[model samples]
Target: MTSPRPHERLLASMMRALPESGIVLFGADSVFPMIAIFAARRWGKNLTVVSAVNTIDPRPDFLPYSTMDPPAGHRGSYVIPMAEAYDLVGRGEVDHIFVSAAQIDAHGALNSSVIRMDDGPDKRLPGGGGLAMILRTVSVVDAWKPVHLRRTFPPRVDFVTGVGNLRHVITPMAIMTMEEEELRVSSIRSGDTLDKVQDATEFTLQLTTKESGLSRAIAEPTAEEIDCIERVDPRGVRYATEVY
Candidate 1:
């Protein structure tokens, strides 16, 4: 079999970093979180993946095209009402929360709602569904985006839907984390260089005087991980077409 793509490898690494077992919360449309749940299960890490409206312990055999729509014959352990989920978030009971960002600034604040282009309602983007509470109370918040562009990793986002509580920001080219309220490049894919990472981002990366080298090498996905991803995403919708 061929090797996993760069993005896949990055995502797999992110998934591996999750706690071995706990109550994890995944975004409705987040791809990596779902994949990570499947990975954790496959790796024998007992975890309950909580959706915004349901608790998926022992996730479905077939991955859903969207979190709101589960596959045929799939069942969740119990339904998590919106109110209950929000309460859990408010209580800070959720171990980890995974979210996808449209725009993330240096302060780790994210803008996933409202048209950031001009601030008006003309092009209203998808408003923050549960990010506000999730960011405020979730112990760990991981944000990711499929795209790697200058506009995506801006110095500052125009609008803030969720502020603070960002732990990691995984992208196609690198893995970024906040340091001293500023975004720092922590790791880079094998083919990606410091110059490329800097070109794609707007913030000044803190590379020197770090524990790891300038760019922490991102390892390739193992065969077992590839198999898990294949089984979880049978239609290959998440992996195919090089799209999220």
Candidate 2:
């Protein structure tokens, strides 16, 4: 049997990230970073795509073929700032945001900073880019909205750096979300079960069933879809493990 590919897996992961309505924002290229370049064209067509210049690298087809770039001073329904994406979340211009966390906690707090080890630090990641304020603005306080976090690293986050609307979490093994400050496991990846997910994470991640009973991972990849992922990111990095 053929395995799923990366870009396609990215798209499959993104499809699960979206809401049926309202403004959606993406923080980095790791997930659905921009609307103009939203990566969902291959699986289906006749989909609505909003384009943003100050955002992540978009799918090439969105360029001269399907979508027209936004003109200067255009106000997109949902906005993403390529330069200051984090700031937009604080102001409430975004309803949902997909961000990669250095480490995340059961309480939904994020830590984008690095671990201070004996040798200064092993790596320096992007520090809390407006995450604190965004967390305060997005959490149960501001309209009680939902945020999604994608982190491969775990164990209650080394430090609390950033914050998202923090509705759910997507990892290589599972899908999870917060319910009133409690981390709940959403769903297991397509091929994996809850036990497998628990074994992979560093911390004790609470698993709950997502409303959508599917993993962001391709339930079943098409020959073309699998081929597409190989053509783009041949390494076969799958990002969308959680469908929440």
Candidate 3:
């Protein structure tokens, strides 16, 4: 009967946002793939998990911290080439995609390339692999970042790695959605406030009007949700990259 931890709550929130049934493509991030797998198994939602490693509908016994782990593809149904996976996305066969970014702008554009600093040399990051194409082609793209800070949610990203079809940007503090091509605070996470979210964000939040959807708050993880999360991630791999 212990309360769900911060990372567990975050995982439950992300899992609840997933579609009931569709092909969900998980990026290279560690946590998102775990959520997708949990959703697929717990709800029996007919959800198909397409891993970044090109494993189609993998049925791993336990959630792997890294989607590339061999256990992630253990007892899988089929293995498709990476090219074919992207081709499916381009053909609109993919339903949802989970991606991550080092920096996300108000326009929902993602930056995973490099961070330009004024006082120091440019800090290079791992470039977005297939993010540009997948984001544009996928019907729904949900992006997540473990840490929420002003630097992470900037007014504008230094470089645009991907921009299209970004529906929601989920963070530990809040969930921002695209409205009129701009990111707006859709729902503040449990135990978080609008002030805290605004203070952590770099852009001016459009939460003044009722239509801005600032009144909505993310629901806390239910007992069932927490149970599912624990069952899938008994080793707590969901906390592999979480910051809070």
Candidate 4:
């Protein structure tokens, strides 16, 4: 199997930090989190991966590339309506929620609503399918963006689909969490520097204590983690999404 890509490695790093057992929900169409669920399962995390379209606890090989596609085989253990799936969030049963981001600000506010470029405003995005409810209900909300660049990580978002529940933001180069309601760098991907992360982010990012003349070092991806990604995504689909 080939090596994992930057985003895959970042996802694996974030997912590995989850507690051993809990109900984890992925955004409707995101695939990298799906790969994390499979990787967590492979490592015997003993957590349930729930989805409304496909089956719960879906096998890696059985999973499809997009939500619009049909499950290949043995999709999952059970199927439920999308409404019922969100009900889990309402009841506070979900421990962690991962959603995609069109734009994220320094305050962890997310904008998956519409794209307003300098030339002109774009059409309203499909927006967060059920993310508003999840944000209000779940304690731990994570935002994942495949593209890690200035345009994507703007200082402010055009709209706020959800607010005040962000725990971490995972991008191709780094993993960030809120520190005192502001974005702070927690861990960076292997070979990536803090300066690189600061440059990519449009907002000012708080450095970890270690980065600010402290006697500690930020953690980077390990060999075992890259191996885990290889095992979970041997075909490199998760990594390929970064390019295409």
Candidate 5:
């Protein structure tokens, strides 16, 4: 099999759209989050990458910001509280937030805070600190909806900690958006047709875009931006695979 192309990798997994400024909460080992961090840096948007535990950078050259604290492990949004997340966004320091979800609904709600446990009352994880605050306060967010572009999406979510105003959700197949409280298919992924992308998603969608395909918000890459993404994501490819 042929190796995936750079744009292919980026288009495939880097599906989340970001607000101009905000905080993104993701796991340190998450591949999509890593790609988002790289792309967010290229866009020159102000961002805060929040992890439950401490993370250190070995090759810190690629990231625009460095991770503080040492290698440690913990659970919960132990470092920060949900209310403080409100303070951050309210103070203009944060305008959006990203939380990796285990389930998504047509309305663009995420259920990353809930985890199914064996014979138990479905364990709930601290999805992220400020997702609830970000949604209610920031009024905007970027997310690839409909369950990572597949059947994991449903008519209603199991739980909603943060109902992201879901500015955008990039899937392996297409870009999703909010059209009057409903998630709509705004942009088709390059090399795929609308029907092709639609067939891959679980939720029903309506097209709101005219010329829609994989295009950046800025469209063209700046010299510094290109250099940055290429440095960490060398080969100009983004890693969205679960293995990464």
Candidate 6:
């Protein structure tokens, strides 16, 4: 069997962060909705996807560019206003939410707003549409970044758009979690090392240990998980670069 690609392994890692039986609300990004659907199918009958477009429970046949895209909500059981969905989050009905950031800090505060520049015009990113409320209310927030770079994981974000319930930070190279209110390297991806992760990150890398007193590391994506990702996203939408 062929080895799993970085995105596939990242997707599998994201899937593991999800609850087996709860409503998972996905953010309006390129990759996470696909992961949400895979988790729903793999876990079977227990996982429900509340798409970013407010679809109650969508089972999209193919991956969409953004979760807010209409095709992402295709074949859904029903639709509800986004306000209602936020209500669900406020009521603690939603167990988990997937969020992304243009920049994230050591404290897990996110910046989806503008990137400050001293020499030139500041770059305005896609501002947090509803991230402030969702991040604050959701029980768990799993953030993913396709690229693992020093600028992406900074010691402090340029602007704080959201900062609540951020439990895990998933990137192409590693999986980090909150420890003592600071982001720590919980698991390095298979074939990746702490030195590589630290080189890509702006802050110091602190390794987390398992209950058995061993270091935590990401398991290679199982063959079954790779197969599911391939089946759902043959066009490789998950690998596409974000416009913003």
lDDT of 6 by residue, 64-108 (tens): 777667877778898979788878888888888778889999998
Q: Model 3, range 1-244, lDDT digits (tens) per residue?
A: 6867778667766786788888887766556546645654585567887776778888778777777777877676889898888889888889887788899998889999999999999999999888898888888888887788899988899999888999888787888888888998888877788889999999989752335433478778788888787777788786666557
Q: Who is ahead in lDDT, 3 or 4?
A: 3
Best by TM-score: 3
How much does candidate 6 score in TM-score? Answer: 0.90
Candidate that beats the other on lDDT, 2 or 3, i.e. the better one? 3
- Estimate TM-scores for all models: 0.89, 0.61, 0.93, 0.85, 0.63, 0.90
Candidate 5 lowest-lDDT run of ten:
64-73
What TM value does model 5 have? 0.63
The sequence of per-residue lDDT tens digits that candidate 5 reaches over residues 1-244 is: 2444444344334523554555554433344455556466556666655543432122233332222222212232345554554465666554444445677678888776885656878877757555566566664556643234454566677787678556666665556767678777776545677777667667776876544343523123334444555565554334334321
Q: For candidate 5, give the lDDT of residue 51.
A: 45
Per-model CA lDDT versus the true structure: 0.72, 0.48, 0.79, 0.70, 0.53, 0.78
- lDDT (tens digit, per residue) of candidate 1 on 13-58: 6677677778887766765677767766776777777764466563
Quality of model 2 by C-alpha lDDT:
0.48
How many clashing residue pairs appear in each of the predictions shown? 0, 10, 0, 0, 6, 0
Error of 5 at 202 (Å): 2.0
Candidate 2 — which pairs collide?
36-51, 54-82, 111-161, 147-165, 147-166, 147-167, 185-206, 185-207, 185-208, 186-208
Maximum-lDDT candidate? 3
Candidate 2 lDDT, 77-181, residue by residue in tens: 444455555555556655454555556666777777776567574677877655677666642211111133334445567677855467666544455667757
Candidate 4 Cα outliers beyond 4 Å, as residue runs: 1-4, 52-54, 72-75, 209-224
Better-scoring candidate (TM-score), 1 or 3: 3
C-alpha displacement of 172 in model 4, angstroms? 2.2
